[model samples]
Target chain A: MRAGLDIDMPPSNDPFYAGLGQAVRIGTELLAALIVGGGLGWAADTYLFASGPWGMVVGLIVGVTAGIRNVMRAAQNWSK
Target chain B: MEESPLHPFELHNYIPINLFGLDISINKAVIMMWVVVGLAAFLLVKAGRSRRMVPTKLQSLGELLVEFIRDIILDTMGKGGLKFFPFIATLFVFILFSNLLGLIPGTYTVTSQIIVTAVFALTVYAISIVMGFILHGVKFLGILVPPGTPGWLLPLMIPIELVSQLARPISLAVRLFANMTAGHTILGVLFGLAIGGGLLIGWLPFAFTIAMNGLEVGIAFIQAYIFTVLTCVYIGDAFHLHGADDHAH
Candidate 1:
């Protein structure tokens, strides 16, 4: 009694919306990774180690790398 | 009177209740959630009540939404994903309704609250993590290691992956909250300009306000769609660790 069993392409079909969604997603994906990494590093610096800027520096490096990986992974999902 | 664009987001409690030192006050956002849940329930029940061969408009719309969600789950998580249909469907419907309902002027967008979105993100992430551990036991840790990584890079890759994993819920929560908050803030600014500019020069900003509102509606649908899709993808990853990796690659 139901229709629309085959509606498989709503997300990929509409370029305007799909692009907007993907763009928004990727932007935050990158930022969130950085934030998490840096936050972790900053916490370690403040709480655990009296390490003068090294913990944060290392954390930011991991954050940037993770951010790139996230962007790449998200990009791989595109229809192109 | 010129009001800040963010003035709309302020919460003035209707009824403040403190239990065990927890403030669970009733606010616009709380009322909006009740309204959204009630409306969604009423529509869905009415739509599904008459399961006739010739489906009515509401029934068709409901079917379309269900199938759309089913397709997302199937595409990401495969046949096994059907078991999650109830959770996934509820999440999709609740978010879609909340986003659309919030677009109405004078109504609070419940999702605009970081705490609300964070709860959803945390719940989804926790489910995936718990399910992963249950299915794979110790091997769930393997998810942190991407396939085909050289042994030498294991130490470096593990930390990076850990950070990325932690970022998933953060991104999920921030994306929805930021989008809703940003969209509403733009609308508020445009509306402020429209009012303050008066009849002489207000029409331009007013027209832009209408246009922005239309765009915001589209954004509402897109944000909801993205959230559901990512939820599926994350859960699917838990279902089969390397499955999504292969598909995406």
Candidate 2:
């Protein structure tokens, strides 16, 4: 029981748990940024402007960039 | 005989209640929530009742949980965060318990539902936003702009930061919901194959189901941990605007 308890002890120091936590977080951060940016772009195209395909195109690009930026920030935290 | 992998996720109301046209129904998820709250309260209260220099098992577990959550608050929010111990502790315990408890064969996973996770995420995000406004007033808007940015880039940078900021709650909700849903779906598919395969090839997928269940347990713990850490980080950012970018070399 003690050994089992030690597995989760100070997750920041435990390689396996920390590594797993970091991985899931980074994956979601990238995806979420993309979803937000793209969704906003789509909404703008549909509601605000009658732009055809252009709005979505710009939104996707921004989404990808934001996703990468999020991934970088998450990585920086991991390295620290 | 074919069954959808998502079949288990469907909810059936036990006692349907409509109040002011809102469907507030008693279902598996709702019952599970009550069970989780009751069990957690019982365990923690029982643990607290014991006063001994030599701690009992339950007492030690309670202490470890407290110290773990305390360390998280201290690391992210600093000494001032001790005020939020109760909030953080409740979030940790509730999430951790639900995630672990949902793994049982007959129990429903409350966190697997997008609505449940979304509500929790929105509440946390709203609290951070309100706290920032109350503490820093109008200056809380400065969070949209990073610490080191020239005037020329402000136009482009602000929109990008704005999108990322809006994505916070969305990411938090989607992450937990997707993980739990996907994990269970895979388990369901594997178990279905195991059952349908009969005595010959059934053992293989059955074995994988067991392995995946083990992995899911680890996922459960990691998800709860990440949720707590991010919650702390978000609130901490409200406490100190532009603090995260201070040491950028």
Candidate 3:
């Protein structure tokens, strides 16, 4: 009875095998994101502790770099 | 008459109700859940009532929601996933509306409560398990055992995969709850400070509130998207789209 309401059905024999390779790729993408995000966060917290104009400059650079890294990772992995 | 800025969750405003001799305090979270359900039903009915080539604003709004959800489900989970549209659509609408509703002054955020969010997470977890088992029969657990893993490593890998699989619901629920609660509390504290402090401090807090509120709106859309996408991902696992073969990746 509940089957009646299902509108989305998986394609028959639609290469379920293909996903294994994709999973490996996704795992790499995830690791890359974590490593990049963590590395940036740490760098910002460490060397950017100065409160003067120079500190602001370094912090901004680190933030932008980290943010870009995250975006790149996401953009790369968003497709099937 | 002045209204209380404090939401129902504040302990000072708490009320208790007795049902059949069982004392259950009717918390703000419960009230908000009721409101979410009511608003969802109202929007759906209003949106469903009129069928037209040229739709009115309200009907068009509903149609837009339907189309939006349909596309998301179709795109991410494949056409086969459409069968679960009602479930997914309901989940999205309920979560999206509930999160937005909490933004209104004087309303409690049910999603902010861990219990409430956990229930949703558990529901997703249960469905994933049930669907996996039904689709794969005894092979449902086969999902945790990735194909091509060395036999000796199977013990370690399976446990890790199983743990990660279990973590899905907790992560799903906590992410939404934490984001919503943190944002709401920050907004609350800021606005409260705005009221308590003079214009100088108030101005900064007020600006922050507005910016955060805008961010929250973006978050409302994103959480819905994330929840739906993850749903597709889990369901995809059930179908073994990623290859559940014993020697698979």
Candidate that scores best on lDDT = 1
CA lDDT of B219 in candidate 1?
Answer: 87
Per-model clash counts, in order, read 0, 0, 10
Candidate 2: RMSD over Cα atoms? 2.4
- C-alpha RMSD over true interface residues, each candidate: 3.4, 4.6, 12.4
- Using Cα atoms with residue i matched to residue i, what is each candidate's TM-score against the true structure? 0.95, 0.94, 0.70
Instruction: Give lDDT tens digits, candidate 2, residues A1-80.
Output: 34435434435666887777777887888899889988888999999997977888888788778788777876776566
Model 3 alpha-carbon miss at residue B44, Å? 1.6
- Candidate 3, A1-80: lDDT as tens digits: 21223332121112432342233233333443344334444555566653345544543444344334433433455352
**DockQ per model, Cα:** 0.56, 0.47, 0.03
Give per-residue CA lDDT, model 1, range A17-51, as digits (tens): 77777788889999999999999999999999979
lDDT of 3: 0.64
What TM-score does candidate 1 reach? 0.95
User: Which wins on TM-score, candidate 1 or candidate 3?
Assistant: 1
For candidate 3, the iRMS in Å is 12.4
TM-score of chain B of each: 0.97, 0.96, 0.86
How would you encode candidate 3's per-residue C-alpha lDDT over B1-249 as one tens digit per residue?
133443534532258777899867766676778889998999799889988777767777777678777776666566787888999899988888888888887776777777777888788778878988898788777776666889998866654454445555665676677677777877877787777777867788888889988777666656665666667667656766344221111
Top TM-score model:
1
For model 1 the local lDDT of residue B193 reads: 90
